[model samples]
Target: MRHVIGREEADFVFIQETKSKELSDARCFVIWGDNNVGWIHNKGDEGSGSLLSMWPKDVFEYESHVMGTGYIAVYGQHLKTSYRCVVVNVYSSCSLRGKKTLWEDISKVRQSSHVLAWCICGDFNAVRSSNERKGITDRGEQKSEVNGFNSFIDSNFLLDLPLVGKKFTWFKPDGTAKSRIDRVLVTEDWLLLWPKSKQYVLRREVSDHCALVVKSVEKDWGPKPCRTIDAWLLERGFNRMVKDK
Candidate 1:
């Protein structure tokens, strides 16, 4: 996964279901390029613990905690996740308590006014709307989960970028349909700072889920030609040679 992503020249990358046992050395080598990289891994067999990792040899002023799966709050500049924004990587559990844990973590971050721009990316493990599902019929319990997810986003004023092409990120190899489980959520302030922000689904090779690429408009220069001809190329001799040919 890291090798493939490295080729894409992505600034930041978030991965879930890494299935690593050790927290210290859980990240793939290729993901850690010449820039900074942050990660939070699930701890324990029951998946109740979390791990955070980063690179680039810069000390980051951060506040992080282990909820259910993992959540890492990073404060740094020119990092893999951002050039001038704070990046939070999270992996929430799929239980009732997990929802509460996620909410608590988010609330803590909101209380901290130090964070200006933020982008939270990971496997939420919960569907937001019925339109996000594929085959599973909305049951009472599922509806409740969806409602909780929507409420969380609404209260936080987060925006889920409109997905293009494939709606569902994960699917059963047996041909059964499923919901769009994985996503990248950004705060209103972050969107305002980067109005051209967008997320793209990368091809899934090793894992069952596809990877997401989130980009900001900080470096956009519109569309431009790749090459240009100098005045010498349009000289009389060059025109005469072309005419002779």
Candidate 2:
């Protein structure tokens, strides 16, 4: 967990399925590596699910937050970019009926906060297509669920950002089932704010689901640009071009 965060240099992080009713600042500090983070948490109910959304105070100005049954929406200003936006961290229900309510809840928030750009991200617990799931036990109810999830995205005008690291965000321990249920969906306004934004599916070390990091591609995550002398100045063609100019 720490490795992934460090590697990404994440400004914000959203985690679901915390399964803890109470979280201490000390614990959070350990996970976040400092006290400079501000966070909103929704404790897990019994064995259901929990949510935690964290952002560096230096990078994001904390405003207000809204929390529902399965999600937490944090509204703030991204200091680096000076853009105000809302980030919704979600952990959905396994059943379709429960999931519908979750979707509606988020949609209501979106409608209410229509002016603010939105980044809706987390484990959706649903998929948009058959291709996204494999080796599933429940095929009978899959198609309807797919349609419902898709409809939610379409109705809310959210764009599903392309994933970079992995095709599937989850895999059964025995390698039986695989699905791309976790994702980052953003409003068009949000896309305009961070045009190079994409979600990276990173290593799944301790959890069954892979850690997701959504960031703008400032540059390709590769080796630093190599320093070079002005070798082109030595070329005869370059001298000719300079002379012609």
Candidate 3:
């Protein structure tokens, strides 16, 4: 984890399923490779799952945080952009019912804070499409799961950025099952600031799940592809405006 942070030159980090019950400042500083680091760590569900979020204190100004059922969110302003935003670090439940509650919790947080620029990243433990999973034992269950997860992203107006580096983020020990459950999702306002942002899946070192990093590196291809969210079609007068245009 330390090596990845250093090599990637990360300004922020989100770690899920951390087994440690408590994290010391010394360990956090060591992992971040600096004393100037701010973070929030959950007590975890009996050491089975915990989230550790950290950022360079010099880069991002720490304001306040809200600790919900399964997530931790921090509100701060970026020193460089002076953009006040909320970055939610999540470690959602594996079960569908529990996942729904987690989604509601996040939505309420976003609503209460009224901060539109958001960058949510972590192990969702859910997939958005059927193709994202392989060797699934229950096709019916998987389909239902996909629908629920997709609905959450669409209804919240969160953009699931294009993935880079790997097709599957989780691999079974025997290589029988593989799924793309880890992701980084940002709201439309956040996307406007960085249109080319992408989710990068890093190498799985000493862990079953691959680490995910969100990066925005601009590139110019010959003809760019059109990108838009589906919710726009449901808005009143959208169809007429498109036809008139």
lDDT per residue as tens, model 1, 1-245? 22111112554455454555665432344546433544545453543434333433343333453334356555555434444556666666777667767866776676664666677776677888778778766566777788788888887777897665677877767747766777878887777766777776777777677777766545658998667478858787986776798
Arranged by TM-score with the best first, the candidates are 2, 3, 1
Question: Candidate 3: deviation at residue 24, Å?
Answer: 2.1
Encode model 3's per-residue lDDT on 34-81: one tens digit a residue: 899998888788766777888888778999999776788989987778
Candidate 3 collision pairs:
none
Q: Lowest summed lDDT over 10 consecutive residues: which window, candidate 1?
A: 1-10
Task: Report the C-alpha lDDT of model 2 over 188-212, residue by residue, as the tens digit.
Answer: 9988988888888887888888888
Provide the lDDT at 104 for model 1.
Answer: 68
Error of 1 at 174 (Å): 1.1
lDDT of each: 0.62, 0.83, 0.80
How close is every model to the real structure, measured as TM-score? 0.70, 0.85, 0.83
Show model 1 residue runs off by greater than 4 Å: 1-8, 23-68, 79-84, 217-245
Q: How many times do residue backbones clash in model 2?
A: 0
Error of 1 at 241 (Å): 36
Clashing residue pairs in all predictions, respectively, total 1, 0, 0
